[model samples]
Target: MKQIVARGALAGLLAGVVAALVSVLIVERPMRAALVIEDARPAAPGARGGDLFSRPTQVVGGMVAAVVVAVLIGIVFAVVYRWVAERVHRQSAFARSLHLAAVGFAAIVLLPMVKYPGNPPGVGDPDTVDQRTNMYLSLIAAGLVLAVLAHWAYRALAKRNWPGPMRGVVAAGGAIVLAGVALAVWPANPDPIPPDVPAALLWQWRLASLFELAALWAALGVGFGLLVDSSARRWAAGQRAAVAPT
Candidate 1:
């Protein structure tokens, strides 16, 4: 069925591409520059993890690796999105798809730039900085495109009133993202810099970068109308009523 496909394969692919792209363009580049490697050489002994920081044998290797990771992360997101979107609001397949994409773009692409401190030339290159900034803008545009189009499509699918408990999920999603952004933009020094990280400063920057990832999906709930405004309005009314007591 269409729902099955959306919940499984299609969702996975979308999440993978967005997550990987965001990781590469925004997170990966900044982390790379921060490391200050003199040469783009192969990893040596003690470079064990083969993480994002690992120097690639070929461009293809890096690309493939990124895609694989993106896909895996995307699959997880697909399930989560479907559960919440369906249970809370009964958003259609297309709407959920767009919402996932937007969330990925915002979290991966936009949030990084918002959260991180600029690393100037001595600290980092202008080209790298510019690329990261441009990438963020592109992701934001992509998210808006997804949101608008999906919203249009969503008009046709089943929709729910969204219960009181569900609104908590939406608010939580927003808070998580905001927290991640705050950490990356102003990261604390991580205890042990991962080996691929060439320097101490790079390690610190990456520490901040990793934490910001939490917000990627969280932002989606806020932007995509996953929350229940009714409760908020009611609470405000209650406050006013209490204040008007004789």
Candidate 2:
């Protein structure tokens, strides 16, 4: 039990650091570029650059904050992985991890719409509507993709010993369904006019962020799963060694 917990925590911490770095590289950088272009093109731009890129110092600070948050999140995820591995029935740790991740992704997609702050709603009268819808649509697509990928991964791992076409079908099906649902449910956002930033951009960034998170979740799941499995195998080997005697 202690070994599993320790492994999970270590894996989670590693995943968090990697994930934060990936987000900074892939999502933040591009978002910054988009913001810069948008700000430069504006007829009368506000003091705040429309992009995260305009402020390099701020961006770095944001990245640091993100890294810290990711680390904490990683630890929590690790603990959950250990608990689930120990208590789950029938399904392997991999399967449980993937399924839980899918659920987490889905919740993230729905967050802007259903959560406390509500959606961005753009800068319109209905401050919640446009932002909320835009966020939902963008995240839903990404969330579905993540779900499918994770599910297929789980299926593949669960049935690792299986042979031939059966395994292929199972894996493919899992991936497809996981991605399809979220995309289908996503709602589109209206383009923001001059002086007003487009909701689509916000949604796009959010969507990309979700993908970054999905990658982290996948890594953590795989890493923690392998660790737990390895620990169990080692323990079994030790028991065999003891019973056989010197």
Candidate 3:
């Protein structure tokens, strides 16, 4: 287990590097454009370039943040991987990892993003920032609960010997319905987008952000899965050799 966790961290480190590169290459475009808009606005007396940090500093910080967050996430993945080892029921460790990552992405990233979409510079209403943040956080917790419910629903069906297809469909459908209802009931963002920040540009930024997150999750899943699969293979080979007559 210790070895597995170490490998998971290593995989996460690599995955972070991949995510960082994607952010630098793809996300930079829209982000820079947003910055341009931000610069044109009247700067508050104390603001530096109308922001706390320069672009270069922000870029570097973003990369480092990505790596650090990925490593932590990797550790969590290792722990969760152990917890779900038997429950996932997938033949391949890789498949199990991918499955868990998909659920995590949906439960954490995708859902919150839908509820409180990220904005680029000069986009958000500063007065409502606190409210927006609070709502976003609550939604994230709700999403996790929703994920647990969906998984539990699937488990209940499995215990009853329901077919795999039926179990998945039912669980997924229930989750979607619940999510849709919640979204409809939730308060919309109180901030009207600044007219200066074009919708097209905002969407491009959003898409880029989503793509980066998706890439991060995908890389983490694939990297950790491969590492686990490799470890299992080596363990099996060693056991076979140990048991064989010389």
RMSD of each: 16.3, 9.6, 5.7
Model 3 scores what on Cα lDDT? 0.87
Candidate 3, residues 93-189, lDDT tens digits: the string is 9888888889888888898899778888888777888999988888878888898899899999999999999999999999989988878777888
Number of backbone collisions per candidate:
4, 4, 0
Residue-pair clash count for candidate 1: 4
After aligning candidate 2 to the native by TM-score, how far in Å is the CA of 76 from where it should be?
Answer: 2.3
Better of 2 and 3 by lDDT: 3
* Candidates arranged by lDDT, highest first: 3, 2, 1
lDDT of 1: 0.47
lDDT of 2 by residue, 142-175 (tens): 6545644654565556666666456657665665
In model 3, where do residues sit more than 4 Å from their true spots? 45-52, 231-246
Better candidate number, 1 or 3, judged by lDDT: 3
Q: Model 2: how far is 237 from its true place, Å?
A: 16
Alpha carbon deviation, residue 144, candidate 2 (Å): 16
User: For model 1, how does the per-residue alpha-carbon lDDT over 1-246 read when each residue is reduced to its tens digit?
Assistant: 344324444434443455445555656565557445533445557756434544544434655665565445545555556555654455444455455655565545555445443331134343455665664555445444543343443332324555534553554455455445554544432233335444655645554444334333433333222222345446657889999968
Q: What is the lDDT of residue 18 in candidate 2?
A: 71
